[model samples]
Target: MKEKVGKQSLKFENAPYIIGAASVAGPKEIDGPMARYFDRVSEDPTFGKDSWEEGESEMVRQAVMLAIQKAGVNKDDIRYVFAGDLLGQLIASTFGIKDMEIPVFGLYGACSTCGEALSLAAMTVAAGYADNVVAEASSHYGSAEKQFRFPLEYGNQRPLSATWTVTGSGAFVVSDRESEVCIKGITTGRIVDYGVKDSLNMGACMAPAAADVIYQNLQDFDIEPTYYDRIITGDLGKVGKKILTDLLKMNQVDISDNHMDCGIEIFDNEEQDTHSGGSGCGCSATVLAGYILKKVSSGEWKRVLFVPTGALLSTVSFNEGQTIPGVAHAVVIEHHEMSKGK
Candidate 1:
């Protein structure tokens, strides 16, 4: 039987299989460095929808449909759809997946929605609560900009510390049945607030939370930094990356050799004007679906620690001058070939 691994972690004896994953991104993302791996790219910013919010919904729906099709499972076969977005009340997830006719559990973890959704979906399958589930997340540049900052028409100067919001969606189908990619374990994060009030620099606000989770996972499992081929974080841009590395160094665990951030990997610094990098639910979700999983499937990476970080702030709270808190969740994915060798 599957059992709890350690503090804040769960061991999946069945190791819920990642049957398939799909990424759908906007035109700018489609032209980014990791563009080739995405399943679908929308050339239109609105994606033929009347509004940016509606466009985000389309991306989620398409991603879900594509992932299900790739998994070779009927929509009816999925027991539940676990999804979320940066938008208020998960509007994107609710309206986007409504047509699928599958039961859903809407989640909100800021940019870490992907990781949270994946962890819960894996746990549900591992615990025999479900046979298959779809975990998905999305974000849109225009909608997030208008909601969080000034509208696009304002053309407010984005400081170097500000990261661009990604316009994309990613969906993953996790099942109890065997597959090429499977989830081995998970480390759920805690809310950490360092009293940072600057809404522009999300990386700085979320780095501490990411570091804490990484350190906790390591200590709980009695593992070294070199245990995995890569220790990947969601969207903690360049600034957060340094903070996380410095924090880990204090803990006597160095991950610089293998640490990679999805935000840093997604865009070319010089070519793209994405200041620090990308941030949003889609930033890490799309990267995980389009890049990391593909790398693992090819046997290039044996095991990986995929952590997605999120800044817990809203327009109301930020406007009221509340500090931005952050959280992160970890998922350990291993390839079938690697599992066989073990």
Candidate 2:
């Protein structure tokens, strides 16, 4: 049986393994620092589709199929799929997996959808509900901008704190099978609002929630920040990175030495002009599938706390003058070699 740790965490009795993972990114992302790490990069922003939304769905399909292929498993063998995107009603994820005929649970956590999907997939497998499952998340710059902000044709100027939404998708196959990387535990976050109203500066809105979860994870596990080789956040750009570190320091839990932000890793801010950095569901998802997993599989990183953060505010909420509450979900990933150390 899984042990329910303090407040909002779970310690798995039979940790689930990430047997395979895949990342599919767009041209903009291909030009970024972690470009070579992606499984596939499409030169076409439309992904051969007529619309940006359709292109995003195609990216999701490519990622999910490739991950299954890498796992050497038949599509029929996949019991369920947990996926979502930064689109209304999860249309992107729906169209992407509709033809596969697998049972699916559409989720939404803004940029944190990847962590949320992965956590639920791990829990399902750990609880013996299925032999194998797929977890995926996606985001596209064009579609996100059209829905969340202004139209592409508008060409509105962005503030320095604004982050570029990543155009990419990442998928993973989780199973009880032995593998190099496994999920040991999870610490789910609660909605935290600091009365921040600026949607452009998402880092400020999400910093409090990220801090809350990190603090709780440390307390629940009875460990310090140094317990893991690294603590990675999803899309908290340059601004969020500073706020996150400072908030942790206030709690006497310092993680500055080993903290990494996917947003910061994906792009060269100065060169790319991606002011703060990258945001959206794909930012952390793609980095984890492409870069972080490689480090863990090769034993360069023994353990990691993967926390994807999100600023929860829709265009409707923003226009309606509602505060942007933030949420983050943390997953504890470990190398198979760590089993021997234990």
Candidate 3:
């Protein structure tokens, strides 16, 4: 019942079931390789909204409602909703879910907000504080570009390492109710800065944090790369995936074959001119909801180590020339096949 693991990890005694999940992506993402998996796609990024910010909020709104609907539950069934976004004040989430009337825990972990929310939601359910909880996170290319970097009008040339901010939202219904997949444990990450200052290069900034959290999770659980069928990292893109691989290999933990980056899987590198790949809260959120859990449910993977990485920086910090600090949280998800083995 203690559930406490090593310093930064927790072992849940009663793992919460991931009852349902839904993802909404923009037109660009709909054209990607994982498009078929997404529950819904917005033909236009605006979704007929007045502003891109409002459009981003609408994405979150639709995603949460779809997730709730897919779970066959009403809004009243959800005890709490943990959601977040890359917007300045998390307005994407606040304005989006305010109508749900569910008590909210608005989170901010940059791109890692999805993992943060999921971990917290699972904790709430495991602690018997809530029967049903919804964890949602979103990002919009237009909204994030306006807030974090130059507008499209600026037409600034992007560096090869630059990643596209995905316009999408994903929501998950986690509960004590029975489901095909469940969260077994969680490893909370610490903020780590390697003096990365390039705002355009998020993969470089976030990789170190992903490595740190994954290594800690492995040590805490005393497991090797072979333990999980897949070791997935969120939004690390192509460059960050290399960095994370190198860091883990240096620690004598080789996970090259089993490791998969949501950023890398979400797009086709050669065909899609996404540069390094996808990056944003939506990058991992939609991938997890749309693809990762699907694999679990289908028994394509018996167990998975899911770690969502984040670059914790703001417009003010970037403008002030502060280094970008990275953070990542690890969540252990298991299939019933592995449940019996464990």
Candidate 4:
């Protein structure tokens, strides 16, 4: 039987390394002169869909194909595909992978699905149940706004904590090969709730979860903060990132210089007009697929930890006054021996 991480046990299987990864983004830049927030909508015609329903699945499909190609793996070699998105019922992921000719397992992790998918995919490959696995996440602004907040035509004022939805998709291919990036270790988070009532400020709601998992990952691995070249968090914006730093200090762990957050790093906060930071699956996905993967391939940084955090509340659940539940998963990526030699 495959070894599983028990609820309270820190024991875990070392993640099989990530061999390949890729990301894609919508053409319309929402931050430019044509920006209208909600009124303008996405005017980019490349989406090729009249509405959210058609475009989301297309983005997911494109991301998966790119990842598979980059990984140098054929579709027939992928044992299983694990994917998710912010859309209701994971419409983007389900429809996107339907024709990939590989068995698929659908997941729902709100905005944190990217890390969640990677964690599970690494586990599957590491445990030897499969030789190759594909994990991916995608999101679009139109569908997310319509489903989570309001209709496009509603034109409601957003709260200061409301995060700008990102338009992009990211995918990764994990395999047993020792030539590319290796998955080091993963730390899974428990549901945490501190009675924070505002869903708009998801950073506040999810920061604790990110901190908890980061602490546990270090504890579980018996590694020091300095051991990693960088420690990255998925989508905690400015406020949440601060909260996470403070929380880590409480545990005697300092990740100051080498730490970065995807939501904060993806776009320039001042230039992009992002009030706090970026959010959604695309936030981390794009960063990993675009920036981090290239760095790994180039041998700029050898070892890094990626923790994607998620707020597990939905529109209906939030409307019913349920407190937000949060979770995070950590994946370590490093250059392999063969790659480093080259």
Number of the top candidate by lDDT? 2
In candidate 2, stretches whose alpha carbon ends up further than 4 angstroms from where it belongs are 338-342
List all candidate RMSDs to the true structure. 1.7, 1.8, 2.0, 4.3
Per-residue C-alpha lDDT of model 2 across residues 1-342, encoded as one tens digit per residue: 347999999999999999999999999998899999999999999899999999999999999999999998999999999999999999999999999999999999999999999999999999999999999999999999998999999999999999999999999999998889999999999999999999999988988999999999999999999999999999999999999999999889899999999998899899999999999999999999999999998889999999999989899999999999999999999988644543
Each candidate's lDDT (Cα)? 0.92, 0.94, 0.91, 0.77
- Candidate 4 residue 40 Cα shift, in angstroms, is 23
Candidate 1: segments with Cα more than 4 A from true spot: 338-342
Residue lDDT tens for model 1, 78-171 = 9999999999888989889998899889999999999999999999999899999999999999999988889899899988888989999999
Candidate 4 ranges with C-alpha deviation above 4 Å: 1-15, 28-46, 339-342
Best of the candidates, TM-score: 2
* Candidate 3, 1-342: lDDT as tens digits: 489888789988989989889999998898899899999998888988998899999999999999999988888999999999999999999999988889999999999999999999999999999999999999999999999989889989988788998899999999998777999999999999999999888999999999999999989988898899999998888888899899989999898999999888888866888889998999899999999999998889989998889998999998898999999999999885443432
Residue 288, candidate 1: alpha-carbon lDDT: 96
In terms of TM-score, which candidate is stronger, 2 or 4? Answer: 2
Question: In model 1, what is the error at residue 237, expressed in angstroms?
Answer: 0.4
Alpha-carbon deviation at 262 in model 3, angstroms: 0.8
